[model samples]
Target: MDVDTAPKPAGPLLALRGISKRFTGVRALDRVDLDVHAGELHVLFGENGAGKSTLINVVSGTFPPDEGTFQFGGEDISHLTPQRARAIGISPVFQEFSLVPSLTVEENLFLGREITRGGVLHAREMRKRAAALIDELGFDLDPSQRVDDLSRAHQQMAEIAKALLGRVRLLILDEPTASLTERETGRLFELIARLKSQNIGLIYVSHRMREIRALADRVTVLRDGRHIRTLDAATSTDSELVELMTGRKIDLLFPTITHKPDKVMVDVENLTSADGSVRDVNFHARAGEITGIAGLVGCGKSELIRAIYGIEPIASGTVRIDGRPYEFPAPRRSLKRGMAYFPANRIVEGLALSRPIRENASMTALDLPAFAGFGVLRQAAERIAIKGVMEQLQLRPPNIERPAGMLSGGNRQKVMLGRALTRELSVFLFDEPSVGIDVGAKLEVYEFMKRLVGTGAAVIVVSSELPEVLALSNRLYVMHHGRIAAELSGTEKTEQNVLAGFFREHLLAEVA
Candidate 1:
């Protein structure tokens, strides 16, 4: 093939042709073609099941392509193993991190590919090398610090640092900035620029269009396991990209709804965790409003909510639902009291992905008379009970027995919401519900939140996206270092104000 030759056509550093993959009855990719050039950031845009993950996995050697070939530096290396993939200078940073929580940054940096002598670990040299790498990347992190102790942003940095440990020529990042703040995202962009300067090829997979505009040299769209088309990023509009990705253009990202909060539903006073990660947290959610919580990644927003749901043990707190005291370390107790907590990662914590929708939805109502006793699921009764919420949330295909994993990002969330709706609730706690889903999915989740709160149920939303919080919440609280820093409402519900609140303590300390 002319592709495998010296002086490779000033073209792609890596080129994939006619790639196809199948799993069971599902054809994940079909004749997908992609090209990534050295010194270029190539963006792969696709909706769920569009073959983006399959293609990347093929390149990363997670699995072999059933058909087609991949050329690396002009050589057809289609049937390569993961070791060979790394040996040839390809490193991938996936959305779910691989860093071990128990290990230090230095230890994790050289984990499997460690420096060894006399069949013993070379800890000192590894630490030195890791320290140098962190410094080179301009990351503010201590090499000796445990991975569990680091903030999400710092953990992300550590993930990158681990990937760059080898002679990396092509770096693939999947949703790298999904959890990062604006400032953190800027820093990542700067680092990417530095890598690009070294003539390294970059495959950046992101749902955020702003990232593509800011970084992409070219954009490739995949649809239903086939290559749709590739366009120059500079010339492509977001609408055009959306059309290419979803096959339909959505003009509105969010639906407008007036927020009218009524009487208090869930009230917390002096909430503090044993670890002090969440300290003296005090807030309230009204019967008909979204109480938004916004802060940087490490702040106590997550822990504070977890404390209320009885997931995180509270050292001192008073939680009241409908003006009555509530207890901690008792999830069933909280659930029975009409309080539902939805986690950010729906796949792992929120729902059993492999299970049928019937089981997932009915899990919340196991204590209900129709679902209890005999230790066997009353399938017919369960379906009838969950049918209303499922229809209301508009789960695609409306298949009651579909596995939760088969649904798209948006539908998966709806499944969680459906389960929540089945239970009578006074307070609904959502933590970053709109993480990786598309615009349409986000609007659906937003609509669900509105509907739930409209039924005289209180909702507390903790999101990193300031616009989302502002749009969904009637009242907002910003946390910094385990405490509520500022509370905003009405005219004060601006992104700028929320950010100010996020850094209020730091600003005060700096001023002092």
Candidate 2:
């Protein structure tokens, strides 16, 4: 496809000069400057808490910048409201889903701008247009389907279709492919290419290095809430980009697992879920080893782990912890049996976002000897304990008093992991522990997991990213349709082997 060569404007299509934002005296964005061309796929790279999101928020008019000048299409748009920004051709697809669950795809697509005849909404016309738009995007989705029933990937597609319906001069995609499969991601890239051909400017934010290389024309790096540097994507390597974003060399993102596999810490036999999501699942997580669970979405991997963690009810199964048969009817029951679970939705399930960092970190270990005094909580001792965990995890802005909600994605993850580390546990269940975290923090997490294994703790990690599972696990299990379809150990655990197993199960089912 030929590059779109539209008439060049006098100034940048969008420019942010000396942007600064503050939250309770914290300099979230400090004198940041950025520029996006008219038809360029400009990538924004930053570590967690480096102020990428804050900068985008300021640009998109989600938050009024304390100090900055935002120029767009030859006008100063520094203080425009979010609605006004959207009206003037700036749309954003945030990390979180923004669609209303109860609304149908047609309603979500043309939500506020439904076709009107005689001052009445034309539902029939809106549906027809939405169906055509869905077809144009090559997505197999019904226009009348409720948004709540669609998969996350499909919801994301709906968001892209909605953005395309507007006069979108600049489309900002924040971690757009974070939850998509390789095939779905390819379709998204194709759509992005088509958008670029129409001279639609794009500001792409992602942690995945491969996506940036494939989609970006130029790159901007931010660190510690400041603009660090800008470079042409064609001239940058993944390592170089990592160095720029992190300000240090990242030799190994995944630490070497040295702990030998020992006794089985958690054993699940014939576990099944009520929804039939998981059936006859069997696995044993060994002490001092990282056992990984990998599968495509809806493959029963999450259900299998949740059942063991007591988050989901089990139909017929026996869970043994250290050779003791146990009935884990609740999370507290599992916790009391020396089991810790770091849920995938950390913000929602793992931490108390409204509470202070120290409280969240020390919640599980409050009754410990060090944190307890005369049958009461000792505030001083709790602070000391939480501080140690923060230092070990390298949580940025390491303030124990800050609300967990105010921390960046990586730091929030650290707090979640800190909760597990506070209590002495024999088994740890991690569900997508590094989902929204940055590269540097991911390395820190990898090292922390290795350290936990070194201390004779068993670890079970459930992840959708194949590289993360292959890089960290001592044993790998691939699940398909509620059962463990294949297990790879020692020299057999490779990406090719896992993919082959995944596809082979599909082929067998097709034949059957």
Cα misplacement distance, residue 419 of candidate 1 (Å): 1.6
Clashes of each: 0, 0
Candidate 2 residue runs with Cα over 4 Å from true position: 1-11, 365-381
Question: Which pairs, if any, clash in model 1?
Answer: none
Can you write out model 1's per-residue Cα lDDT over 1-512, one digit (the tens) per residue? 00112332487899998999997667889998899988799998887657777788899998899999889888889568888898888998977688999999999988778999999988888988898888888788899999999877788889988888878878999889876777778888998998787778899888888789999999999888899999999998988998778788778766666667788888889989988999888898887778999987768898888888888888997988788888754678888888898888776588888899878887888987777667777777888877776888777658878888777676778888887867667788899988877655677788888777667778899988777888888899998888898999999989888878767777885787
Model 2: clashing residue pairs?
none
Instruction: Report the Cα lDDT for residue 47, model 2.
Output: 91
Candidate 1, 295: how far from true, in Å? 1.8
lDDT by residue for model 2 (1-512), tens: 12335566766799889999998868999999999988789999999999989887777779899997888887877468878888888888887667889999889988877789999989998888888877877777788999999877788888877777757788999888866767788888988888877878899999888888799999999999989999999988989999999899888888888868999988889888878899988899999999999998778887888888888888898989898898855788777888888887776578888899999999888767888978999888788889998987777788989999888888888897888768868888988878888898888888889988999999999998899999999999999888888899989999999988888988887899
Q: Which candidate is the best by TM-score?
A: 2
* Model 1, total clashes: 0
